[model samples]
Target: MFGTDTDARNAQQPDKPIICEVIDPTGTPLNVRATPNGEEIVTTLSNGRQVIPYKVSYDEKNRHWILIGDSLHSWGWVYGSYVSCLSA
Candidate 1:
């Protein structure tokens, strides 16, 4: 059988595009921390830092808090109000 060429493979994954919103009061940073959480122990933007949220989770016990980070102890239960959906 013959094969067909499609540009679909070259298309980017919109579901998890490389984008992160500034949850902190300030979004700019002279430099940002690189952790499993990507921004754990972050500058909170007060120090002027930026980060990309690769992963996010929710917790029932901490309904108002957000579970951030991929490593143990690295996770943070920050207020849901602090974060926003990273735009493309």
Candidate 2:
């Protein structure tokens, strides 16, 4: 019953935002790239940092990359494997 209220509210709102948290296993900050698997490092996210995922992409090696930010702006691309997402 703890999350029942929140779940019901989310169920009623199909357009509710999805929240993601950084979960890098290496215990280091996760890099946010300018592009999927690109050389440019736009920023970094620490473990447990929350972000909103907007889109997803795959690299040549099939590595999953997620575009994260808010509705009005995008932060950058982060490795999908290093993040855990939940609907909020």
Candidate 3:
């Protein structure tokens, strides 16, 4: 209702570096995975913690995955469902 189809898709893709906060519905630390799936968890992030994503990725079913950190840095993948974009 707000943006066009392309705009909506583009909004999901971060153009500038920004931070999103962790928001686990389970009231605990959220799992940061090596990939989008639940199989390989690389780290755990507490609620309200901020993460900087290099870009957004999608799973086979089109679920959003945030590429936390960078490929050459301390990076991991986290499902976008557990994160809330604060700005940008």
Judging by TM-score against the true structure, name the best candidate: 2
Q: Residue by residue across 1-88, what tens digits does model 3's lDDT show?
A: 1123342245355454456778888987888888776588888989888776665667888777776663357568877777765445
**Candidate 1: residue 87 Cα off by (Å):** 3.5
Best by lDDT: 2
Report the CA-based lDDT of candidate 3 relative to the real structure. 0.67
Clashing pairs in 3: none
lDDT of 1 by residue, 14-52 (tens): 464333233554444322333322345553333312233
lDDT score, candidate 1: 0.34
TM-score of 1: 0.33
Question: How large is the C-alpha RMSD of every model relative to the true structure?
Answer: 12.9, 7.1, 4.2
Q: Runs in model 2 with CA error above 4 Å?
A: 1-16
lDDT of each: 0.34, 0.75, 0.67
**True lDDT of residue 12, candidate 3:** 55
- Candidate 2 vs. true structure, TM-score: 0.77
Across residues 38-65, which tens digit of lDDT does each residue of candidate 2 receive?
8999889899888877777778886667
Q: Number of backbone collisions per candidate, in order?
A: 1, 0, 0
Q: Once model 3 is optimally superposed onto the true structure by TM-score, how far is the C-alpha of residue 39 displaced, in angstroms?
A: 1.0
